[model samples]
Target: MSFLAKIFRRRPRPKLDLSHPQVVALSARLRALHAMPISSKEEVAAWEVEAEKLRERLYEDYKEVYDSLPHEIEHYLVDVDIRAKDPGYAKYQAEQLVELLSLPEEMPNQSPEPMPLKRHGSS
Candidate 1:
Protein backbone atom coordinates (compact mmCIF):
# COMPACT_ATOMS: atom_id res chain seq x y z
CA MET A 1 0.00 0.00 0.00
CA SER A 2 2.87 2.36 -0.45
CA PHE A 3 3.51 4.42 -3.63
CA LEU A 4 6.00 1.92 -5.13
CA ALA A 5 3.26 -0.74 -5.34
CA LYS A 6 1.13 1.67 -7.44
CA ILE A 7 4.07 2.28 -9.79
CA PHE A 8 4.84 -1.47 -10.04
CA ARG A 9 1.17 -2.54 -10.58
CA ARG A 10 1.19 -0.74 -13.91
CA ARG A 11 2.38 -3.50 -16.32
CA PRO A 12 4.65 -0.94 -18.02
CA ARG A 13 6.74 -3.33 -20.11
CA PRO A 14 10.19 -1.84 -19.64
CA LYS A 15 12.86 -4.53 -19.14
CA LEU A 16 14.13 -4.36 -15.55
CA ASP A 17 17.59 -2.89 -15.47
CA LEU A 18 19.37 -4.90 -12.77
CA SER A 19 21.89 -2.08 -12.76
CA HIS A 20 19.17 0.29 -11.50
CA PRO A 21 17.02 0.69 -8.35
CA GLN A 22 13.77 -0.66 -9.90
CA VAL A 23 15.05 -4.22 -9.66
CA VAL A 24 15.81 -3.69 -5.99
CA ALA A 25 12.35 -2.23 -5.47
CA LEU A 26 10.78 -5.19 -7.31
CA SER A 27 12.78 -7.62 -5.17
CA ALA A 28 11.44 -5.94 -2.03
CA ARG A 29 7.95 -6.12 -3.41
CA LEU A 30 8.29 -9.82 -4.16
CA ARG A 31 9.55 -10.45 -0.66
CA ALA A 32 6.60 -8.55 0.79
CA LEU A 33 4.20 -10.55 -1.37
CA HIS A 34 5.80 -13.80 -0.29
CA ALA A 35 5.63 -12.87 3.40
CA MET A 36 1.88 -12.21 3.26
CA PRO A 37 -0.55 -14.87 4.58
CA ILE A 38 -1.86 -17.42 2.03
CA SER A 39 -5.39 -17.89 3.52
CA SER A 40 -7.19 -15.54 1.11
CA LYS A 41 -7.82 -16.02 -2.65
CA GLU A 42 -7.25 -12.32 -3.29
CA GLU A 43 -3.77 -12.36 -1.72
CA VAL A 44 -2.85 -15.50 -3.64
CA ALA A 45 -3.95 -14.02 -6.96
CA ALA A 46 -2.04 -10.80 -6.35
CA TRP A 47 1.08 -12.74 -5.36
CA GLU A 48 0.82 -14.92 -8.48
CA VAL A 49 0.34 -11.91 -10.76
CA GLU A 50 3.26 -9.95 -9.26
CA ALA A 51 5.52 -13.00 -9.25
CA GLU A 52 4.81 -13.65 -12.97
CA LYS A 53 5.63 -10.01 -13.69
CA LEU A 54 8.89 -10.29 -11.72
CA ARG A 55 9.82 -13.52 -13.54
CA GLU A 56 9.33 -11.80 -16.86
CA ARG A 57 11.49 -8.88 -15.75
CA LEU A 58 14.20 -11.22 -14.49
CA TYR A 59 14.22 -13.40 -17.60
CA GLU A 60 13.97 -10.53 -20.04
CA ASP A 61 16.44 -8.36 -18.13
CA TYR A 62 19.05 -11.06 -17.47
CA LYS A 63 18.60 -14.61 -18.75
CA GLU A 64 21.95 -16.26 -19.50
CA VAL A 65 23.42 -15.70 -16.01
CA TYR A 66 22.33 -18.38 -13.51
CA ASP A 67 21.50 -17.11 -10.00
CA SER A 68 22.69 -19.94 -7.76
CA LEU A 69 26.47 -19.46 -7.32
CA PRO A 70 28.90 -21.66 -5.41
CA HIS A 71 30.45 -20.07 -2.31
CA GLU A 72 34.08 -20.79 -3.34
CA ILE A 73 36.23 -18.06 -4.84
CA GLU A 74 37.39 -18.91 -8.39
CA HIS A 75 40.61 -16.92 -8.59
CA TYR A 76 44.21 -17.78 -9.45
CA LEU A 77 45.55 -21.33 -9.08
CA VAL A 78 46.98 -22.38 -5.70
CA ASP A 79 50.68 -21.53 -5.33
CA VAL A 80 52.66 -24.69 -6.16
CA ASP A 81 55.67 -23.56 -4.08
CA ILE A 82 53.60 -22.64 -0.97
CA ARG A 83 52.70 -24.93 1.93
CA ALA A 84 49.08 -24.72 0.87
CA LYS A 85 49.74 -26.64 -2.37
CA ASP A 86 48.19 -30.13 -2.05
CA PRO A 87 51.46 -32.09 -2.25
CA GLY A 88 53.37 -29.75 0.05
CA TYR A 89 50.36 -29.50 2.39
CA ALA A 90 50.07 -33.29 2.50
CA LYS A 91 53.82 -33.62 3.31
CA TYR A 92 53.52 -30.99 6.07
CA GLN A 93 50.46 -32.79 7.48
CA ALA A 94 52.30 -36.15 7.34
CA GLU A 95 55.24 -34.68 9.26
CA GLN A 96 52.86 -33.35 11.96
CA LEU A 97 51.05 -36.75 12.06
CA VAL A 98 54.41 -38.53 12.41
CA GLU A 99 55.40 -36.26 15.30
CA LEU A 100 52.04 -36.94 16.98
CA LEU A 101 52.25 -40.70 16.31
CA SER A 102 55.80 -40.97 17.72
CA LEU A 103 54.99 -39.09 20.91
CA PRO A 104 56.66 -40.78 23.91
CA GLU A 105 54.16 -43.32 25.24
CA GLU A 106 52.03 -41.72 27.94
CA MET A 107 53.95 -42.34 31.17
CA PRO A 108 51.55 -44.64 33.05
CA ASN A 109 48.80 -42.40 34.41
CA GLN A 110 50.75 -41.72 37.61
CA SER A 111 50.76 -38.12 38.91
CA PRO A 112 53.69 -36.20 37.34
CA GLU A 113 56.13 -34.94 40.00
CA PRO A 114 57.43 -31.50 38.94
CA MET A 115 60.98 -31.74 37.63
CA PRO A 116 63.18 -28.71 38.34
CA LEU A 117 64.67 -27.47 35.04
CA LYS A 118 68.29 -26.23 35.36
CA ARG A 119 68.19 -22.42 34.98
CA HIS A 120 71.42 -20.87 33.61
CA GLY A 121 71.32 -17.26 34.96
CA SER A 122 68.29 -16.60 37.24
CA SER A 123 67.62 -19.00 40.11
Candidate 2:
Protein backbone atom coordinates (compact mmCIF):
# COMPACT_ATOMS: atom_id res chain seq x y z
CA MET A 1 0.00 0.00 0.00
CA SER A 2 1.17 3.55 -0.75
CA PHE A 3 2.22 5.65 2.29
CA LEU A 4 -0.39 8.35 1.57
CA ALA A 5 -3.14 5.71 1.21
CA LYS A 6 -2.23 4.18 4.57
CA ILE A 7 -2.00 7.57 6.23
CA PHE A 8 -5.38 8.78 4.93
CA ARG A 9 -7.30 5.57 5.57
CA ARG A 10 -9.71 5.65 8.45
CA ARG A 11 -9.16 3.03 11.11
CA PRO A 12 -12.17 0.91 12.13
CA ARG A 13 -13.87 1.93 15.35
CA PRO A 14 -13.88 -0.42 18.32
CA LYS A 15 -17.17 -2.29 18.71
CA LEU A 16 -19.37 -1.48 21.77
CA ASP A 17 -20.24 -4.61 23.65
CA LEU A 18 -23.49 -4.17 25.60
CA SER A 19 -23.82 -7.80 26.59
CA HIS A 20 -21.10 -7.83 29.20
CA PRO A 21 -22.38 -9.24 32.50
CA GLN A 22 -21.34 -6.23 34.57
CA VAL A 23 -22.93 -3.82 32.09
CA VAL A 24 -26.17 -5.80 32.01
CA ALA A 25 -26.42 -5.85 35.78
CA LEU A 26 -25.70 -2.15 36.06
CA SER A 27 -28.34 -1.37 33.48
CA ALA A 28 -30.92 -3.42 35.33
CA ARG A 29 -30.16 -1.57 38.54
CA LEU A 30 -30.39 1.78 36.78
CA ARG A 31 -33.79 0.84 35.39
CA ALA A 32 -35.12 -0.19 38.77
CA LEU A 33 -33.87 3.01 40.36
CA HIS A 34 -35.55 5.08 37.70
CA ALA A 35 -38.76 3.13 38.07
CA MET A 36 -39.02 4.08 41.73
CA PRO A 37 -41.38 7.00 42.28
CA ILE A 38 -39.80 10.26 43.35
CA SER A 39 -41.00 11.15 46.88
CA SER A 40 -38.44 13.43 48.43
CA LYS A 41 -35.57 15.77 47.60
CA GLU A 42 -33.16 13.50 49.42
CA GLU A 43 -34.06 10.52 47.20
CA VAL A 44 -33.66 12.58 44.06
CA ALA A 45 -30.25 13.72 45.22
CA ALA A 46 -29.24 10.15 45.91
CA TRP A 47 -30.43 9.01 42.47
CA GLU A 48 -28.54 11.85 40.85
CA VAL A 49 -25.34 10.71 42.51
CA GLU A 50 -26.04 7.09 41.59
CA ALA A 51 -26.65 8.07 37.99
CA GLU A 52 -23.36 9.95 37.92
CA LYS A 53 -21.50 6.88 39.08
CA LEU A 54 -23.20 4.72 36.47
CA ARG A 55 -22.37 7.25 33.78
CA GLU A 56 -18.71 7.16 34.81
CA ARG A 57 -18.62 3.37 34.79
CA LEU A 58 -20.18 3.26 31.34
CA TYR A 59 -17.68 5.86 30.22
CA GLU A 60 -14.84 3.57 31.32
CA ASP A 61 -16.23 0.32 29.92
CA TYR A 62 -17.82 1.67 26.74
CA LYS A 63 -16.06 4.77 25.60
CA GLU A 64 -17.67 4.35 22.20
CA VAL A 65 -21.12 5.11 23.68
CA TYR A 66 -20.02 7.56 26.39
CA ASP A 67 -20.84 10.64 24.31
CA SER A 68 -24.42 9.49 23.82
CA LEU A 69 -25.26 8.24 27.31
CA PRO A 70 -25.28 11.59 29.11
CA HIS A 71 -27.94 13.00 26.82
CA GLU A 72 -30.34 10.16 27.58
CA ILE A 73 -29.70 10.54 31.31
CA GLU A 74 -30.31 14.29 31.30
CA HIS A 75 -33.49 13.98 29.27
CA TYR A 76 -35.03 11.84 32.04
CA LEU A 77 -33.72 13.79 35.00
CA VAL A 78 -35.41 17.01 33.81
CA ASP A 79 -38.97 15.70 33.88
CA VAL A 80 -41.46 16.99 36.48
CA ASP A 81 -43.54 14.20 37.96
CA ILE A 82 -46.73 15.37 36.35
CA ARG A 83 -50.05 13.45 36.30
CA ALA A 84 -48.86 9.86 36.76
CA LYS A 85 -46.89 9.74 33.53
CA ASP A 86 -43.66 8.24 32.27
CA PRO A 87 -41.97 6.28 35.01
CA GLY A 88 -38.75 4.32 34.50
CA TYR A 89 -37.64 7.11 32.19
CA ALA A 90 -34.00 6.64 33.09
CA LYS A 91 -34.10 3.08 31.88
CA TYR A 92 -35.39 4.34 28.58
CA GLN A 93 -32.46 6.72 28.41
CA ALA A 94 -30.03 3.97 29.38
CA GLU A 95 -31.51 1.87 26.56
CA GLN A 96 -31.00 4.75 24.16
CA LEU A 97 -27.22 4.45 24.52
CA VAL A 98 -27.38 0.82 23.46
CA GLU A 99 -29.80 1.64 20.65
CA LEU A 100 -27.49 4.33 19.29
CA LEU A 101 -24.55 1.93 19.34
CA SER A 102 -26.57 -0.60 17.33
CA LEU A 103 -27.14 1.86 14.52
CA PRO A 104 -24.61 2.16 11.68
CA GLU A 105 -22.53 5.32 12.07
CA GLU A 106 -25.31 7.04 13.97
CA MET A 107 -24.18 9.79 16.34
CA PRO A 108 -26.42 11.16 19.11
CA ASN A 109 -28.79 13.82 17.84
CA GLN A 110 -27.90 16.75 20.04
CA SER A 111 -30.41 19.29 18.85
CA PRO A 112 -29.42 22.88 19.44
CA GLU A 113 -31.78 25.44 20.93
CA PRO A 114 -33.94 27.21 18.36
CA MET A 115 -33.12 30.85 17.75
CA PRO A 116 -35.57 33.37 19.20
CA LEU A 117 -37.97 34.68 16.65
CA LYS A 118 -37.60 38.44 15.98
CA ARG A 119 -40.44 40.74 15.04
CA HIS A 120 -40.34 41.60 11.35
CA GLY A 121 -40.51 45.36 12.04
CA SER A 122 -38.12 45.30 15.02
CA SER A 123 -34.43 44.55 15.27
How big is the positional error of residue 22 in model 2, measured in Å on the Cα after superposition? 4.8
lDDT of 1 by residue, 9-48 (tens): 8543443233334334443543344344333455445545
Q: For residues 1-123, could you state the per-residue lDDT of candidate 2 as single tens digits?
A: 999999999756444444545444545655555545445666556666765666566656655454434355445444424202343443344355443323223334442222232221224
Q: Considering every candidate listed, which one attains the maximal TM-score? A: 2
Pairs clashing in candidate 2?
none
Q: Highest lDDT among the candidates is held by which one?
A: 2
| lDDT for 120 (candidate 1) | 14
Please report the TM-score between candidate 1 and the true structure: 0.29
Name the lDDT of candidate 2.
0.46
Error of 1 at 84 (Å): 50
Model 1, stretches more than 4 Å misplaced?
A: 1-27, 63-123
